[model samples]
Target chain A: MRKIKQWTAMGLATVMAMSLSACGSGKTAETTTAAPAETTKAAAAETTTAGATTSTEPVELKFSWWGGDTRHAATEEAIKAFQAKYPNITVTPEYGAWTGWEEKQSLNILGGNAADVMQINWNWIESYSQGGKSFANLEDYSDVLDLKQFTPESLDLCKVDNKLMAVPISLTGRLFYWNKTAFDEVGVALPTDLDSLYKAGEAFKAKDPDMYPLALGEYDRMILMVYYLESKYGKNWVEDGAVSYTEEEVKDGMDFITGLEEKHVIPTLATISGDMADSLDKNAKWIDGKYAGIFEWDSSASKFKKALEGSVNKPGQEFVVGEFVKMGDNNGGFTKISMAYAVAGNSKHPKEAAMLINFLLNDEEGVKIGSTERGIPCSAAGLKILQDNKLGDPLTIEANTKVMNYSKFTLDSKFEHNDLKANPDGVYYKVFGKLSSKELDSAAAAKELIKGVTDTLEN
Target chain B: MKSKGMRKFLAENAGFFFVLPWLIGFILFKVYPFASSLYYSFTNYDLFNGVTKTGMMNYNKIFTDSDITRAFMVTFKYAIFDVPLKLTFALFIAYILNFKLKGVNFFRTAYYIPSILGGSIAIAILWRAVFNTDGLINAVVTAFGGEKINWMASANGALFVIIMLRVWQFGSAMVIFLAALKGVSEDLYEAASIDGAGKWTQFFKITVPLITPVIFYNLITQLCQAFQEFNGPFLVTKGGPNGATTLISILIYNNAFLRHKMGMASAQAWILFLIVMTFTAVAFVSQKKWVYYSDEDGR
Candidate 1:
């Protein structure tokens, strides 16, 4: 009896130890899977439809995307319409805000259980489909998808190893947007050049020490730095998968961002961190027009504009599309495919997925409903439909026009690599965070930046 | 004769069949992943890309990479600061609550609520709001004419916010301490009082030595949990203001999920395991000097 009790106790001890250590793998996987399921479940509740069936055999498809409430509502409506049109097909919608969306989506894809149709970031093609097999080739579904609606060049941008992994939804690039109301209140014109921008900063600081003319997060600072470098050297930030700028040039770019902080053109990293908002649009200072300027994607202008609607300043005049800052002789920024719709390679209904993509991008009813929520549609048919109806957000269209005409460089695939751009731990975060916080001098920060870029490229 | 004996032994242990389901699940879910993680630490096993054996590369990188070293320092600082303060606070609260007082049960429930919600994402976000420069803490500070502190931006301040979050959720430890406090005999305190010992002296002499075993248990458990903490730092500061709050778990997560360096992440996980084990083992060894058991011969 004593021996039996001791054996039982030993067995229980082993079980407890195994269970405790298992939390590392078991709990991690559970959390990863649960994160998406909870978000998507909540989102699905919002977009669930009860359409009447007209066919005996029904096919179900899952579609996923990440955006603001406006995009969510628009996509939800379009999905409902698609379900109504194809009574034989049931579309399950999984959508949420962009926070941690990529990590969830990546895990789902790796697990071979992603939505049949996915709204993917442009860089995902290069990152996930390195061997050109992660996503189903859209060209293979040309019979169902309107391949001709997209430009060859736009389509080429989504190709990896000759596989047309996705079709472009729209083109976008970052541009300066200023709060004219705040600038006018400060007795300064909205800056159209770098010199004027620096001057405006000083003027705004003199008016109120608490107020600043601009704010840039770590990622924003990195992109703006690239634009500054490209404008000066008239070259791509990364060329042929290698860092193109020398260390001194990288220092100059870092200096420009730090220079903005010193001149009060932008708030310091410390000040922004103190605000504690995850993104600029959510920041109270930005919403109230204290921080007057932003360099953001053309497609994202409406969200910023919407955020400032209740500002103390004149609501309509709060978000003004400013001209490209004349930092150097060359146009600095690059345009890339904003986002795309792709069918998963593991999806059971590739044809149905392709049809849904077509209906959303090319079908007139679908195009009108989705009108400019995902920027100006890259599809010719979709654009024409919106044009005929005199539809689309004017502010977004204006920003897009400015971006299309101004940006001259190419955004390399490696520019948006997770290791280079992820918050806090990524190279961009570390370099910009340290520099703006005065932890490292410009030369050292620049060296670190180059090393990070080189390491990502080599990987 | 051997077959007959085996059959008889199997019949004697027929009840083992009842636990077979649990045994199978334990091996499949717990044992497999634990063993695979050890193997993965030696390879390049990004989830999307098929696994490639790269012996020693991931482990070598852990030793050589400056980021990994920095992660170790931050994690150690967090554990060192968090564990003692949390234990002390829990014990103090438990001691006070152990006294027969009005509505003590309500207070216990209220205190335990944070332990339930503390590790949640919602609480992490709430903590962020309370510590924001324009948040509740700053509002109070300014109301008292104190200057605002940039808690999220400063290195030490960022670390403090995350550490305080762990310390604030001391309810679990407090409850355990409360239980152990109840177990201490009332006669010991009565005897100490008869000797003219004050309340503090009685606590140190009678109450404490009696609960040393419970304290040791709490210490080991809290130490292990502190090393594995992820959500607070990830959600609150995102290991930011120049990686001040980048704990080992966050580093492991970033490598595994964000950067798709699963092999490297596994290596980091194993390193964390070893660190936690070492701490727990040390605590166990040290307990021999401190902890007292009534049944000392049995122990």
Candidate 2:
């Protein structure tokens, strides 16, 4: 009887843990932002009761996205506006911060219970869609959605074998930004060229040993490597569904990054990581002027600039876009979809889902309400609408426009594999981490990286 | 007469109906998933498209992938260190708590607090904060004229933090050990003390022998739990600083959800199950030689 009791207890514990893990994977997102489920359910319940008497066939659709307060408010306002225009079609808004969003989405997809109208990353359509049925083809709802508002080029990008898997929201890529005040304090001019950046790093490090000229994590280093190889050699990282660069070629890029490390041009892996912030925009160290420069997405430039609030440095004018370090004459900076919004294939209200998506992307009221929340609307009409209203953050618009004018390459869908880039021992982080941290030589890391990249791409 | 009496008793009190909810849950959640996961191991089951049987393909892929081998090695290293160290710590604390001292209940509760908080993602996040560069540990270190340690960024340091998290949650095991220790008759310890045995010797000869069954229970639990540790590494380092702390459970999770390779994850889960079962079986077999109960021989 005692043994049975022990077994039962153990069994109970295991079952309880299984349930906890189901909820635990989303813990990061939940802690970072309010969970979307409760709000979505509440909105749905309210809509159902409100429409019960008069509605012939009331449709309630779930629309989910990842965002901060600004985006959430804008998205909710859009939904409210959308409901006012079409009272029979009630839309429940689900939104949260980006952390753990992918894990939560994957679980929902697996259970066939994802939101009817979903905002997704472009890469997910490629990874999740097999047998050509992962997400609904919006072409089927052509009547409800105004497909002509999107450029043919933009529409063509989301096609996974002639199926419009997702709608591309906007194009975004990486660039450099500097805390101009930090450089002034250190008595060093902002570096315009690669060589000068090296010198500036040394001067700044000498002036204040606590501060790094550029704070770069492993993932940042990898993006730099990609940009370097692409600019100098005009070669795609992956071409013909395989790795483009040889091990030696990749070695050159790793060696260049480590050379920066040797010159104190960038922080050591340990130093930047010391802050333990997920993003430079949120890092206290960056806000405190310990990090003078950032390598960031054009769409995300405003956040980095804004994070200097409550700091010793002047928040308003201290943030400035930096010159692109001259790698070669070629412009290797690239743009890809910042994120995509899609309709679930299993959605019961496909027409309503498409209608909601259409309203957000193409409708005039949706355009005004959603203004610049999801990185400047992708549609020409929508961008014009936002531009006319002056709804965008000026720095974000300037930096994004700058990168757009400079970029000469576009990333393949395979390049967006999170496993290949961000995970522990991932191609991007493992080799770069080793090189920067002095764990492995450039040659050794390069060889390992080739293997990692090749394996991820092929798989 | 025995058969008639059994029928009468069943007719009089059919209280098994009370357990119907539990029985339904056992079948629906536990047994169904366990059995289906085994079936999934043999198929190419990517949850979105469909499940197609490709017998031995997932197993074959597992053998070919170096990541699986590395994941296994990392998990083994964690289990080997974490299980023994945590159990020993728990036992040590349990021994002290078993003493007839003032505020013993308070001490037990205090020690058991960590376990209550252990299974939370918050604790994992706390562990990350406490070990990061500017974290509490580093703050303490710098206060003592030492440089900040790269606790989360270094390969070894990341592994150390993860192991420490497991050991810190030893309260559950400690509680079990404490109960078993209390159950050990004081007469035996008293008699051993009178025989010129020191405290340590008395502990080993009397206390340890009597608690072997409990130790056996704990060993199984700790070993299994340590191998399947997910939250600590997942929330903290993400098995980082170059996969130095990528527990097998983490690998299974990445394969299943992140990569959408459910077949591979299922195969990995089965392998884990087999490994744990083998360990449990070995412990059970070995227990006969050492574990003693007062009524064992009588039974």
Candidate 3:
């Protein structure tokens, strides 16, 4: 009887604690829900109707994107400007860093409470379009979009099977960035060709035996750079419709990088320190005149330059944006859509959402706002506004112009290798990552990579 | 006679009502998930597309796959190196703390803090900071006129660091050992001293035997916990320096969440479960020869 009483008391206490926790969580949910509704109601009162003298009821559109703090601030400013111009359309801005954005967005989408407009990555377009069934086809809204203003290649990137999915907000192209001080100290000029680049690296190493000429992170980016080099050497190692390499050619590519390591031209995998943020920190090696060169996308050039500027020991740092290196005869590198902004298909206010997207990407005021934050805007009008205002980092403008002039859009050969159909991020990194460390040799590595990719693709 | 049967049923099954909540939870959360994962193991279960039966293909692939083998070997290595070291350290610390000392409670709490934050993100971040090439450990070594070691850069080095991390969180086991030590009567020590036994002899004979059951319990639990170690490897090494630290749990996580290969991940999970179960069963079977219960009819 006593044992029974003790058990009952313990059970009751457990129940009470659980209930208390549930209540606490419930209150938070209630507060969030209530606050949003009140603001949204006020916003709805201000939205104007088209062709009416008195503006249609004001509509509040929530916009979310993932970016750094500077981008977030700029986006918030843009929202304020948009609100000032429309007076009727109240825009709520949500922004965060790259981490956790996808998971948070997934939860919102699943709950049917996603923001009206969202910044979406290119790799996720197909997944989101199919899995969530939550993106509207923008074909019907072409009149408002002015697609002609965008480069046909850029415009086409956002389309899947002729169904316009989203508007590209930026174009990102990879380029080689050399540390001017490091090169000049070794009496080597900027290399224009792959052979010259290799020669320069060797020269730099000869001058200073202790320092590595190149400090590459032992991650996917390094492998991708190898692919870029192979393409430049006139071999589309994994390109569609191109002759696929025999095992020897793949080994050759792997050996080339490994040879660089042996010669002390490239830093051992251990020496490369810092994540993307760490690289952007004040005293990072890349910024502090340590590495001779690095491969970076145009979109990040501004951030890198900013970090360089903030470094304590300012070596004469200069950026040279070169074409993606070619190996044999191939001139093209992987070019895909950057990121896009899309309205969820299930959104109650589709027209309002579309209007917000149009205003952000195309309208004169909208273009001005985008120029400040959204990487070199996708729309022609947005580009013009950026050119007029000179709002973006000067290096980014130069890089963007150079890419526009010299580059050709090409498909990533390893796109199929991406485990998008299964895991959205693909097991590509994990599989190839292991191989890079020589955990498996070239033939075995290829077999495993092929197996992992095929398993997901076939399924 | 009819009433007697009713009373007997209530008496025999009284523990069920007392544990009904846990029973329900076990069924709903643990048992249901376990059964569903078994079903999933035989399917091509992508979370987004749902499931499709694929027989023993994932299992077959596991044997043939290099990554899976690496994961298994890495985890097995971690278990082998970590368990014994951690147990030894825990036993030593527990013995020291069992002494009547000044401010023993304060020392106990200080040692217990890391265990509280054992699997926390902060600790994982701390681990990275201490092991990074330019990090505190290397800094200290270099300051001491020694070459800096890349603790988290190579496979063996990474495994060493992870084992140290596991061993560092020996407080909970130590606490249990301390409690068991207290249960070892003062009379036993007095009797041993009267018999002219030294302190060491008293410890090995009287104290250790008395606390064998508790030590066994701690060993089994810690071993299970060590096998499920994901965060330290996942965050500190990122299962790299050549996939040296890619434990099976990390692989399962990568497949299920990162790759969305839920079926393959589920299969890996079951394999881990079996490995843990086998180890635990071995421990239990061995306990009969070692574990000393105070009440000697054994039950």
The 10-residue segment of model 1 chain A with minimum total lDDT is A30-39
Tens digit per residue, CA lDDT, model 2, B141-246: 9999999888756667778888999899889999999989989898987888888899999899889988988999999989989889998888776777666777
Which of 1 and 2 is ahead in DockQ?
1
Model 3: residues with Cα > 4 Å off, grouped in runs: A1-62, A83-94, A103-113, A143-148, A185-187, A203-210, A218-244, A270-284, A310-332, A413-436, A439-459, B1-25
Q: What tens digits encode model 1's per-residue C-alpha lDDT throughout A1-459? A: 744554575567567666656765622111111111111111111111112112234667889999989898888788877766665577778889898899889888887878899999999998887577779998887867888888998999999878899999999999999988889889998887898999999999999986888888899999999899888899999898898999999999989998999999999988887787767887778887788889999988787888888666446556889999988989999999999999999898887788789888988888999999999889988989999999999888889988999997998888899888887788899888889878889999999999999998997
Kindly list the per-residue Cα lDDT of model 3 for residues A138-174, writing each as its tens digit: 6565644456667877766676667777878887666
Where model 1 places Cα greater than 4 Å from the true spot, the runs are A1-57, A310-317, B1-11
**DockQ for candidate 2:** 0.26
- Over the stretch B13-106, how does candidate 3's per-residue lDDT look in tens digits? 6666556666666786699999999999989887656776679988987889766877888898999889888877888888888898999899
lDDT of 1 by residue, B101-197 (tens): 9999999999888999876778867887899888999999999999988896678899999999999999999999999999998998898899999
Clashing pairs in 2: none
Q: Give me the candidate number with maximum lDDT.
A: 1
Ranking by DockQ: 1, 3, 2
Model 2, CA-based lDDT: 0.78
Cα deviation at A75, candidate 2, in Å, is: 1.2
